[model samples]
Target chain A: MATIRDLARRCGVSVATVSRVFNNPDAVTRETREAVLRAAALLGYTPSAPARTLATKRSRMVGLAWDTGHRGPGWRHPFLQELLVGLKTALSERGYHLLMLATGEDADGHLRAVRRHSLDGVVFIDDGTADPALTRLAESGVPCVSLDRPVTGRRATYVTSDNAGGAGAAVRHLYERGRRRIATIAGPGRTHPGAERLAGYRAALAALGLPLRDEYVVEGDFYLGGGHAAMRRLLALDECPDAVFAAGDEMAVGAVRAALEAGLDVPGDVAVAGFDDIEPASLVRPALTTVAQDRAGFGAAVAAALISMIDDPDAAAPPPTVLPVRLVVRETSGPPRAG
Target chain B: MATIRDLARRCGVSVATVSRVFNNPDAVTRETREAVLRAAALLGYTPSAPARTLATKRSRMVGLAWDTGHRGPGWRHPFLQELLVGLKTALSERGYHLLMLATGEDADGHLRAVRRHSLDGVVFIDDGTADPALTRLAESGVPCVSLDRPVTGRRATYVTSDNAGGAGAAVRHLYERGRRRIATIAGPGRTHPGAERLAGYRAALAALGLPLRDEYVVEGDFYLGGGHAAMRRLLALDECPDAVFAAGDEMAVGAVRAALEAGLDVPGDVAVAGFDDIEPASLVRPALTTVAQDRAGFGAAVAAALISMIDDPDAAAPPPTVLPVRLVVRETSGPPRAG
Candidate 1:
């Protein structure tokens, strides 16, 4: 292996000259730059990036911390995939690397990975409200941003869709469609997004002057299985609700299956709406009426927030930027039919 | 921000002695190590890991390269998810960091990232069979391992599950259950795993002395929508197969919906079995009877292969290890009555 100094000596130039040719060619004469380039190619000399980063005080590496177990593998929420694409595309523009740091279940391992990689920043996605990665990131003095969940009690920046507003819009849509007995399959309450969505559901019901019934709301884990169980419980009620709003798409699909099994027609016997409008939402029979979170936009916002923090560590972070959401009315939600 | 050399002079010891306290504490006397540690902590001195790694010629960072547009974000495949978990757990024990490198829309970005990061080894997961990442990894003299795909024309180490064998087991399960007219929703024919699975399906039909009808086989994109459309076409036939075997669980879920829509009962009227027994398999109403890949073992195998290559670059690689598969006969498949 040839050293940079060897190339410098071979090119008949000072080491500083070679560094100038590589880092900023405009600073060196054309002839000197050509000589340095020839020597570098001949000796297969690759500049030490980490060393340069150390000198420049910029590692050019970003941490991608995620909740690996939020939903089981194989049935990845397709909504997140779009967000990832947007995030990766933006990060590449600035020449930064993404390192996967899965949270929970061996957190020490994640912390160790972070310290070893020397990441310049971290972007956390799909984590619960009380994730420890936030505190660890804070202590490390690395610029960090959270997506989908606001980092609580911390000065960390965040980018998330308007979950509460989306849920409210969904409820309003159901009410406008003439649904009085509206029920919701709320996702796990521990997660900030989930809790906010549930709050929105309650607020909408209260505004509509409808008495909230315990039997109408069932705890759903945000997967198809949980939705199926919740839907079954809702249907077993003495007077079942005319409409259902599921927090996640998977749960909504489960609700579809439960409705079909009971010989009830979608939008006639019961209407269903979901959030995150995953790929399967449109493909399923009759399609799904749901709220569409701008997944790619959310990812872009988070990436932009992280880059801003990296650019100005001491800059006052604009209050966690919240993206907007809209209701996508499909075939599922409609006016209630006569009993 | 204090330098280690400054802390060493204050502690009245050589720089090497202070390094031993941090890097190899066991080599130093406990009292001396404690003194050095206390002084360093008080001075807020931190060791520069990149400088140490450059001197030692080991970054302790493993590269994970995946073809862009594959598993970049919408990772819905259960098998891949399980494999990720397995790989993460196995490599954490070896003190190696996994850096995700997407072989950009083109291959240049991937090469740049790999060259910049100075990765120790790389594992390519679920990429195309002729992906450029394989060629780059081989040329870079980096020990590389291909997961779930064979690296053709390259002597690089590879690990995969027995796809053909898994498929054969599924067919045999269906045959034993007395389903003669067996239809299959095969994946795209260009991929290795999908092709092998299709071949296995054919081989079983030949061995069972059953006539293989061309109409019974439809190419699906391995998604639920494709499955539903394919199932609809099969249902339109003058005579449909008594059982259907889908290459993936999502497709099988679609088949379940199609069957129900046609007023057919799963296993009672039309048996449905899927491969890659993902979490959703059991969650679906009747549950899926399919072939289960030892995903964790597969992940471990890839990690172990990559590590061994790193340890002995010149040593001959063991033959490609194929993890075993099992037939999980759930409620989806049962004996076929006169249809």
Candidate 2:
């Protein structure tokens, strides 16, 4: 209920001086600024975050730009809530909040809103959008961090899982289990994770001296249906693969469903592996053997990098960070039962 | 890149006059304001949201208060990501952003943050914390909407599923399947959904003229482990119920796992049902027969109500919303076969 006038009157200063204390604190004398703030505090005047932004030039709020709507209702970002929890927990400790930015079709419109908000920094969550604007955003010199995307800039960084390592580990695990004819259901080639994971799968096969068979490599859109279709094709090949690895868990589950529908025994007839150990991986029949990415860790790392970019402008932007990943061996991809 | 000074100089106005245009636009004459704004547009001056707040006293930001961390690592809010996606998509249409408000140990701390942000409105995600602060928040004259918790204030409304109706449907479904003795794995008594569901179960049993045996009702937290423990206790009883309904999907899955571990055939020896048609509901073995709450619908409804509150200062707060739910009869609780 208190107004600026009340604080100014109590401090015996002009209203402009009081405004300056919040709008342009540096414009007024330090003593004047302190007197006004101290009086405002006593009067229980709530200073809006924007008001604080006027003086400090920092909103203490981070912008989260995500274009997830394009994914449709069927697709969900794996572990999104967990990632948000992690990001919020870390940011809360430093007195910051997250602002979910709207990313409509117009990329420029998104940037315009970002500028209007005077956001301290922005974190872009990669949702497999090949939008050139996002790629250019990393080069825009704005303090930013990308999740699961590898673009970087003067003040932009990225946080992602070790896709290549995880994929390689999955392939090697299958090989160790005596799976000689290995195949893959990969994600779209456009996404960073997709491309890197595919590369890892190939590299692992190359290291093991397995011939690269084009028929074994199937491209999926990283959803259940795509995985299922790819698996159907794999099963139809003249020489079916002894094992299959999917780039994501959703697809892996689909692959399992497809195999089961085809009357094949999982891990016995054809072993299967997947990336991203989402909840269903363990709950699904056969208990998916997949790689587990640190979804929460990605959030914490993004927050840290963005904060670092904002707090110390003098320092270089945090380098692209790759959190570790490990394979979770479950029922679906164990070794052969007998000789 | 343009400053207020540049715009002021361009318009041949004093720097104070330009400041007034942003900080106190009403104080300036219409002609002077028009000239200043036109010049600002021409010069590409980016006014911070805080500056706009100073002029209009409206910050188009909403607060999201959730206390999920306390639930510990093992606990996860089922369908959170879907709920958030729905909320964000709807909010995006209105150019509103979500601000994650930190609700740490100190209840007052949450309120302080709320006040500091000058949020247009708030949407509180209920995470089973019965802090009086949340109850009081509804009555604090701040425009707010609660999810899954029923509390109303002058400017507060809540969005929740039809717990009672859903529970009754589940019970009746089990009964029609020839289950004479029915039991329930209930959620915490403190939560609104939990209490309402328990009441619904009792009402259904009473309506059926079946004796409400206290031994059949087992209380569990809204988590997987709780349901598992509750199921274990139920199995140990001298006379086990033929069918069990868990208040949540996670718990229902746990109950199924417990029944299987105890060598009981689901839908044969011991039927199971659950609420919340989360992703794992259909994926888990026996495909849980559960009550499907519209998680995304809850988000959309919450957004609509909160926005209505924020936009209309004089109208009455939207009344509490109880979204409809439907019974999904899957493999878990189908009718029994011939002897």
DockQ of each: 0.32, 0.60
Worst 10 residues of 2 chain B by lDDT: B67-76
Clashing pairs in 1: A74-B76, A74-B77, A74-B78
Among the numbered candidates, top DockQ falls to 2
The global C-alpha lDDT for each of the candidates, from Candidate 1 onward, is 0.76, 0.84
True lDDT of residue B145, candidate 2: 88
* Model 1 TM-score relative to the real fold: 0.85
lDDT string for model 2 (B1-339, tens) is 677778888999998898898779999999999999998878777666777676666777788887764456655777787787788878878878788887584766566666777778888886665667877776787888888777768898889889999999999999999997999999888888899999999999999888999999999997788899999999999999899989988889889999989998898988899998888898777899999998879889989998998889977798889999999999999766446
Cα shift from native, residue A179, model 1 (Å): 0.8
Against the true structure, what is every candidate's RMSD? 4.0, 4.5
Report the error of model 2 at residue B37, Å.
Answer: 10
Candidate 2 Cα errors over 4 Å, as ranges? A1-47, A314-316, B1-47, B314-316
Docking band of candidate 1: acceptable
Model 1 chain B lDDT-worst window of ten? B71-80
